[model samples]
Target: MDNQALSLNNTIVATNANVLSMLSERGKNIFFPKLGILAQAAQARGKAINATIGEAVEDDGSSMHLPEFDALVNMPTANIFPYAPSFGKPEFRSLWKDSIYRKNPSLKETVISNPIATNGLTHGLSMAAYLFANEDDTVLLSNHYWENYNLIFENNYGATVETFELFANGGFNVADFGKKLNEIEGEKIITLLNFPNNPAGYTPLVSEIATIVAEIKKVADKGKKVIVLIDDAYFGLVYEENVFTESIFVELANLSENVLAVKLDGPTKEDYVWGFRVGFITYAIKGGTAELYEALENKTAGAVRGNISNISQLSQSMLFKVYSAPTYEQSKKEKFDILKGRYDILRDALSNPKYAEYFSPLPFNSGYFMCVEPKKGLVAEEIRKHLLEKYSTGVIVLGSVIRLAFSAVPQAKLPELVENIYNACVDLDK
Candidate 1:
């Protein structure tokens, strides 16, 4: 149909506000497409979410855990045998809140009372999508971001994702981040920033976080609610001089009533309990008392009720044990140091002349993965395939860039592992 004809056929409802229009417009794109990885996951196939979503089943053996994988997942009896609350176990939520606020003492008095638990980071992400996203509201995101965020913000919530590149050449891009803020004028937008990124592992420095707040303030100055969702999946793993805590979470609160910060983070990446899958949604509503907190909590619970029903009872039960454990921080800190050790080795080896010339590190402070923008002629996939097929090594490809998970490989094996990547690239050059 012609543009004029299409316009003729559509009637604008007088009461349909700009927010609704924005929501409708944004709901039409593929920001985050669901991955086939879940098709292979037991929970995806299990009665839990499977029954509701009605996705096709893979097989029955999935019900019985594979022996080797089962052994690694050895949780205390409570974690395995019991059920958990939908929101979260009370004590677990309280302890988890203590873990969050205690990390940032500057905000000991800051009231962030409502914390909703999810099965994992993804669950909290999806819940955020469900809660704030309108029919097609724009969810502004960092240019280089976690892929799965697209699925939650765009695919599921009916939101359009806008972006600004977070960094360049191993440093933060404050100007670019500011420019993106200037571009938005009307409509409700939820701007999300993920740190210790999935592919890049870029954590903004303290100055960078301050700069981000200043930029966000410019937007909120225009009377818009800046719902800045911070995905802190990899927390307490800071290996560099970076702004690592509730800086934005605290700053956003002081900025405006229009500024509501939703922090989507969890235990999946934190406790070395990947399979345990416990996460939480924390709201940082500045200057709000019990009444405001209650209202927000009610809405948050409504979002949980509408979307997920509740986080797993079993996951919550187990997390409570970890919460109550005396060695929680000490044990967790040791694990973080271990992942940190692996990252250090990769960082040191990446400084090698041979590999250093091949790529530049995007601003990375801490996280499992790091991205490399291939120099000149090398395509990310081609090099990735070359590495995998010939060297029997694996790496993830992101557009023209390649992402390496240095944290997963053992610290002792990092030298040899990097050598494999280095050698593969050299062969490609030849």
Candidate 2:
């Protein structure tokens, strides 16, 4: 390991030995290069004769850019053209961290590191995998999880994915989850909890979340270290009354000395900025201090530096501006209301008794999608193909379930979409 990496590992070990033990070999070896070119350039920031930076700048230190491109975006040239800090733009990171507290009031007293920017949630997940997932290590996930998780955790890092049924009895299968955690044969446990889950769009009830937390705590109490990655990509999109609106991160953050909660979320899904590709990763551990969090941040920054160099400065700058606007909150609420309207329409349409014989709708209350499993030996893929060919409707087929992204459909069209899906299932069954 580099001297810097060793220093970071030592810092983490001093603060929490359990956290240090949970790190992958790569995590323990990665460190932000403070003595390199970026460091030197930062040191020369205010010097009269500064030339350490690589970007083209005018004598006055203004970023050189094409007038055509500059006219396209209203942001200052410096904000778009300059390379962002590997950890992210500091001001934007601070603002986003503040927003997390605003969004999850339960996290008010939790000690979490400032958020680090990434290309998107996928990048954030990859970063977490780099830091913690090792070859052959067991990673617990729900069977109804986003498929990309396998590519990131198993394919990229060689971690073995162990899955539990996502739902049972029309709700989160808390019992199955506990059973999976108990079945793991190691001292370090890594699991992902994605609320408003990708395909099912189900956010657990508060009591269910409490039970989940208790199950994780049980593992921690057994002298095991736990790393829980909370993917809140579709956060703040709950359309129902009884859902656990606050992130599960809040509950897990202060749960145990052996538990490290990493939150991956961003504007990509939450703010309706799919093309912006901006996301953040944050860290929280029990008994955490500023120094300990800073060390973790430095190590994560090093991973960012090594992998993608940094997140897009233009996207970060644009989002920062959007966040600063006074109308930002209202604009977000408007979009949320629109999506919630679609969710309501889809839910109502799915409730029709006529569709019950074709397929069964899964429990869903929030987020962009809902899934249904074809009934009576009907294959989901066959139903998907029938829908596409016969009705010109498109939906994703994941094993035994078909996923519908109701958020993309207009409120008026949602009923038609659901009806077509039911018709397709009926056609396939015939």
Candidate 3:
């Protein structure tokens, strides 16, 4: 009779009259305490996390001559310290165009430049939901997504987030993705695909990438609007041979006119500059006027101006300087090598026959984290809890999987971490 029992027993269908009454008054849903907490926080404009945000400066305390950084700090002309134009600085946006090409030259014909800088990728995501997604639209999400995406789409935008498996037997499962695509009975189907994916650490094979683009094209050819959002938060961190070295944006752009690809990427992970908070949103339309591009840019800027005013000009300045450096690629490669070293340790540690059968890799080829699926019959959460409470080693849990980030763990401490985790899972059978 009460709310608790109604929720547990799934007896809400009998409340049709009550639901209709509430809907007419715009009080259409029952209250949950977490939603109330969120409401209060939103009313406060995110001040709860204010003190923790640092306009952080990085220094080793040993290098007095920040030769490059000095130029970055003292030599910016327009987009430093002042308010960035709602769309962004014209110079920075132009530079961003050049940067995108340096990696994916094929985007010259397919993608357009309607970029808006956000404080971070999360802001870009919020804008994505607002600009395109209708309230009751369905978002076909990758099976293993970044955990918080649900809070944004389902909670914030009132859209259904469905899942399509990223892989089946250690590679992209074309059939699974196609099956899910067919099930969505809508003209505008939206999907969020994260590469160098969050927990799985998998990227599509070139053939698989081709298949994906082709299928999205198939959907678009049916006169449907398909928005393929490529979350490249960890772009360019490839440590393996065939796991998509190119951005998915390149693949999507090659598809039909109806396929709109939005890429959300940032300096946070790739540049090893977390506090810099420099991120951008880019749209790849099949065709558009420069003025149409400008109009979209203005709308995006409207969102930026409404949310955080603008991203810090100082961080943008610093990153632009880095992007211009001759050794930028070399510097990025050095860090990638370090990450590869850490992942190597994790791979070898897990390969020991003693622990090999307990779990499987999420086709891990790139990115900071890897997904660990429990062995047949053993649930992922049980193993995860066993590891943390028993070993004091913390890790993230995603449904029936464990997300192990090799980037955060030091090389020396890694063996111990994996050993403890494996043994914990082994102990689970007891």
- Which candidate leads in lDDT? 2
Give the alpha carbon lDDT tens digit for every residue of 1-430 in model 2: 6898999889988889888888999998999888888778888989888878788888667898777896688877888888898999999999999999999999988889989998899999999999999999999998988999999999999998999998999999999999999899888999999988998999999778899999999999998899999999999999988899999999988899999999999999999898888999999988988988998899899999999999889999999999999999999899888998888888889889988888888899999999998888888888888888999999999988999999888999888988898777777767
Q: Which ten residues in a row have the lowest lDDT in candidate 3?
A: 18-27
178-257: candidate 3 lDDT, tens digit per residue: 77877888667788888888888888877788887777777778877777878888998888776778788987754665
For model 1, what is the C-alpha lDDT against the true structure?
Answer: 0.68
Q: How accurate is candidate 3 locally (lDDT)?
A: 0.71
- How well does each candidate superpose onto the true structure, as a TM-score? 0.80, 0.98, 0.80
Residue pairs with colliding backbones in model 2 are none
The per-candidate count of clashes, in order, stands at: 7, 0, 0
lDDT of each: 0.68, 0.91, 0.71
Query: Candidate 2 vs. truth: CA RMSD?
Result: 1.0
Worst 10 residues of 2 by lDDT: 421-430
Q: Clashing residue pairs in candidate 3, if any? A: none
Off by over 4 Å in 3: 1-80, 108-111
Using alpha carbons, what is the TM-score of model 2?
A: 0.98
